[model samples]
Target: MSAFPEFIPSKLSFHLDSRLVTAVAVAAALYYALYRLQKVKIHPNEPPIVASKIPFVGPLVGMVLDGGRHVKSIGLLNRDKPIFTLPVPGSRIYVVTDPALAAAVQRASKELSWTPLIPELTKRVMGLDADTVGVVAQNLDPEPDEPHGFLADLHDMVYAYLGPGESLNALSLAAARELGRQITAHAAQLEQQSETVDLLAWVQHFVTIGTAQYLYGPENPLARDPRLEQAFWDFDHGLGRLLLGFAPSLVARKPYRAREALVAGLEEYLSAGRHEVGAAPIVQRRIEIAHLHGFSVAATARSELSFLFAGIVNTATSTFWTVLQVCARPALLAAVRAELAAVVEETATGERRLSMEALKGACPTLHAVFLECLRVGSDSYTSRLVKNDMLLAGQWHLKAGSVVQIAGGVLHADPGIWGADADAFDPARFIRLGEGKVLPAAFRPFGGGKTLCPGRHFATHEILAFVAMIVLTFDLEAVHSDENISVPPKEDRVLPVHILEPRTDVFVKVRVRDARAVVVV
Candidate 1:
């Protein structure tokens, strides 16, 4: 007692004790709440068989990582079922597998609307303003009610710049001749080298040049400018980020220096103001109409770039796959070549080249080949969110705001619709149609109804022409005789990303074919 000091009380001890008690209570309450949530069975709205126990953000995180492998795996597991539900960020997604159910979802676009995920992504990568981007415009209160706001205006401008009609007149006989010359020049260089090149890359360059020439005319220096080439490369490089669903605001925050260079090149072309007297055909007429409708030329030009991006990328991918498949399959390849030879021989007038009609008639096999490739390698899908509570597949009453997806990959490979060898690549599958043989609802590669790709015809023509030229000029053979070719593994984090993704790297050695070697029937 003599050595001990007098005991002292401190206000800090009392404060610390109270705070500690409050923290523990809050933590305990959170734990109890989470435990209860885990115990609670999913509502009848969610199918019992579907896996939905993933915490918080759910399976979306995993789906984003690797092209929805978990979703696809679950789809295979539950193939017999009509519908299943899985958790996604902020909501649960119902995946519709039954053909009828998918049709219902696709048809109900007015009641169930598509979310413009990709368009939003495009806005970000293009480095446009939030208002120009149109994301969350509905929520901004006091939004403009004009019949044609930014998006509609942009669409009209793009249509004027590159859509079908007189607008495409500049892209006529002379343009075609120039294109042919350019293609031949490039092909000759390739033939001389005898080196295996990535056909898709070369085709992309060709399409870009052809598209620019059509939009800006031959006189515009940007049409032949080397600097424009670098800008396009930069624009393409930034595209991968958009496909990954990185925040548009973030991508927009950084100046797209390369894209700016492209825009600058375009400005120089616009400044020239040199119009070919008789050149204002369909394309020029459309531009006049656009101007009359109060469309801004600058806006039209910006929108045209978007058109160029969309027009070429998927078409190039499709063409690549079509050529690769034809070259790799020996019997199919031989049959196509034989068909072409017969057509050319029948129509050949010793002096003039094959007419458009003759070329069209000569390539039915080529069309069939293209269709088969589209069936197997189409990278598009349809999605919608429910607007009202509805029972789907005679089970699972999905509430309003729930998202639904129709799995195109699964549908394309469906054994019931396509036969036992659905997984195998067979061009013959599309060549003949039996009487009253119904195409399965699952056969939607261009999507269905209103949302179907509008440029389908243009794309088909482009692919056929490119394929015809390649097959006509070269004898194609696989570099590795025993190599197996298949679709590249799906990377689906970003919807619609599959359209331009390569399925596999195929090496084809091309040798110049004699004009008489293959008859173009």
Candidate 2:
């Protein structure tokens, strides 16, 4: 069946003759091969060149198939090279390996840009209409009439909502409280009898509900469907394909269905006046931004779904990884719990609660564990479209219109930057932050420069809050007879948007912690 509806035509009414098509295809193939055959030369100011065996399409295909793995394969092979150029047909992409070069790339935004990619992403991933795309383009104008216009660049507007300060804190706090509340309720239910559950699955639901509750407010749409949490995971599983303009309806059918169902639910939720309730500043601003840009309610709802995806999907995965990293190591887990002991309070009625303020100030070990998890599990890649030819680091000449990629995993594992244990999970990694050993660019799990993740602060708070509830409130053990804590194999991981999540959900036997287990500071 065709991906488009029955009303749509399968092909244009007019077509070139078969013989002409054959001739054109042959010419294009010859052109591509010749393009590959041309003796490639790298100038002194240009980075070393690495050519894929398949000419124009090899690098793109490999990246599409296994993003992080492909990057690692190249990054590891060229340990001595701070950077390299991958030439694909019409484009030249510079991949940064060294932290110092990465910093230079971050500052070279004028020559290497991010604006053009945003509209392209929206059109493909969000399936936005041409008119809406125009609005996004206008907002992205670097010099708009109003410097702080609500309808400023899409990135800026999004940053406005998620940027640090009171607005972000309020949204984050609300989400943390809701997640904690739900986890406590779930714990209460499990306390009646010893129960088994998929550990990752439960945390996914908890974070999903908590995030949805805070973002969409009391009239949360995910609450309307029992299967939405799973549905979202299904869609997320195929996200890279969908984002690459693969016809998701045909290639990722289940994910497409899941996305459409969620979109419909979100549309209905807004129609029922649900967005009016629990509307935080971010949500309120998003709605206003869309309205001001001439999007209909349905279009606005669809746009919000993308933001909601950013808010919930990757975040839940990050939370799961953080917990798994901690739980997988007993010494680390004990240390983390002990760090929390200073801020954990047991009430007269035997209820235990974490003081967020105290944890923020006192829980250095937990913070270190969180940072280490991000470094070890991050798959985030930053891209910039080169606008003008320029020399990078006064050495490598970057070509105009080429795409530059800064792979977080590469920087995270840099030996000189992160030390001998760069590839190992060192929970106390960030404890040495003040020692001036690690470069500022060495630990950019949330990315850096203007394109830094606005949700970084919020995500950090929520993950810590959720994990605190679990470790402080429950005793957890893997249910499988042969298992203790089996982390998902690194080889099995696909390049996902956030930290890699286990391919299979982790099941555990859980019981409320005994009073003695709760450390009273």
Candidate 3:
């Protein structure tokens, strides 16, 4: 007792320690109570809320960890239900899993509008300056009496130039011709010896060069400097961090630097009048519109970054998947080759030429393969901002300012909509229904409503043409121990993307056919 006297606790000290513990517990309980009180209350008229273990923090953490796939996880919780509410910190995202509800969302485009989100997207994604963003924001939703605003006019112009007609046909023919030239030139090199390449890398290289040359004319920045092509991809790789807008220069430094380089390249390209010569008519019209708005050349060039992204990124990714899927299956490859042969015509000079019209409209198996790839390979999200509190489908009341999302992955995988084998990669899914069947509402690879992708036709022609040339001209085999070609798993952590890229590269050995036939588009 005498040796340990200093370590002994007095009754008074014990009482004070107990009092402190009680006070801390009381404070924690009160704080938690207030936190629970602050959460949004679900009314009877609103969609049922998916409960989280940690209240306000769970959904936020899920999104932070899962990226675009978080919605799919939440969706799994209520697979039987069509729609449900997910509460994150300071926001509510209503996820629609049912195709019927998605159709309804499209019908309510004005009320659940994508226009309201454009200014924010421009500033964060396109890096547009405040004044330029302001120009884009004008007349986002013009009244009946008001003159049409920039957004409306831009939409009208895009439809005029990109919609089905001679203008779209001209653009398609240009891309097809350029891609055919690239493939033919590459085939000549492969004739002597087999070349091993990363399938995705090779696809990106050809697609970027060919598509950029067509859209921006011969003097396109990407074609002039190869480094800018890498820069654009680097920026694309780090897109998720850039989209979050949390001190991008520090957190996403590489992509930010790459973005700056692209902006400068485009600025120089526009200043030099390169776009004036052979650029696509739609691209030329876009420049004219920018000039009419009194936008500075720098800002106008920055705005073109969006156009570049829309045209190149998804198109290349989709092409990679299409080629991989077709090459990996010998039966599918044979079918594609046979179908393409029918459309390819032998010329007087012994050169073979493919008409874009026949390739797009006549190839049944090829078209089905294209549609199936989009259905299974895409993970796009269609988002709409609720303008005001309104009843959705006369049942669920969505609050003003909440975001509504329709995840393509979730919809595409629903067995109820796509049948029992929804998850399987079956190209025959479309062929079984009938050739030229209108795509169901459930197919959302291009998204839906007023924000449907305007470049869909051009992108389709490019992909179909590239795949047709590659499968017919060269023999591709996976460079691996296994005889069967292996398909890589997709990258799932990125958000706000139409296509989910392959996680790993599939290297293949390419050898040209012995006949050495030339293909002219």
Each model's lDDT:
0.58, 0.74, 0.81
The TM-score leader among the candidates is 3
lDDT ranking from best to worst? 3, 2, 1
**What stretches of model 2 exceed 4 Å from their correct place?**
1-39, 42-44, 139-141, 144-154, 157-161, 433-437, 480-483, 491-493, 503-505, 514-521
State the lDDT of candidate 3 residue by residue for 1-521, as single tens digits.
76466546666678889999999999889768845654556566767777676666676677677877776867866888788887767778888888888888888977899888988887887788898888888888776688766677778788778888888888887887888888888887666688889988899899888878988998999878889999989988888878878888998899999999999988999999999978888888888888887779998888788788888888888888998898899998888898888988887876778877788888888888888889887778899999988888888899888999887788888887667998898888887866434334478899988878888887787788878878878888877637867888787766748588888878898888633453535
lDDT of 1 at 89: 44
* C-alpha TM-score for every candidate: 0.73, 0.87, 0.93
**Residue range 1-521, candidate 1, lDDT tens digits:** 64343322345666788889999999888766754454333575565436444543446666555454456566767888777766554566777767877777766655666644434554555544454455323322122474553444433444454455553333433344444556566655665555565656656667667655654567543454766765675566456554444653366322366666665565455445542423224335544544554445553345446655665567766777787788767677778777766655433543113333445555677777887787777645577767777766555677677777777766776787778888877777776643235344576666765355555655665566666666766776656646633335433444453354464455566666633222211
Model 3, residue pairs in steric clash: none
- True-structure RMSD for candidate 2: 8.8
Lowest summed lDDT window (length 10), candidate 3? 512-521
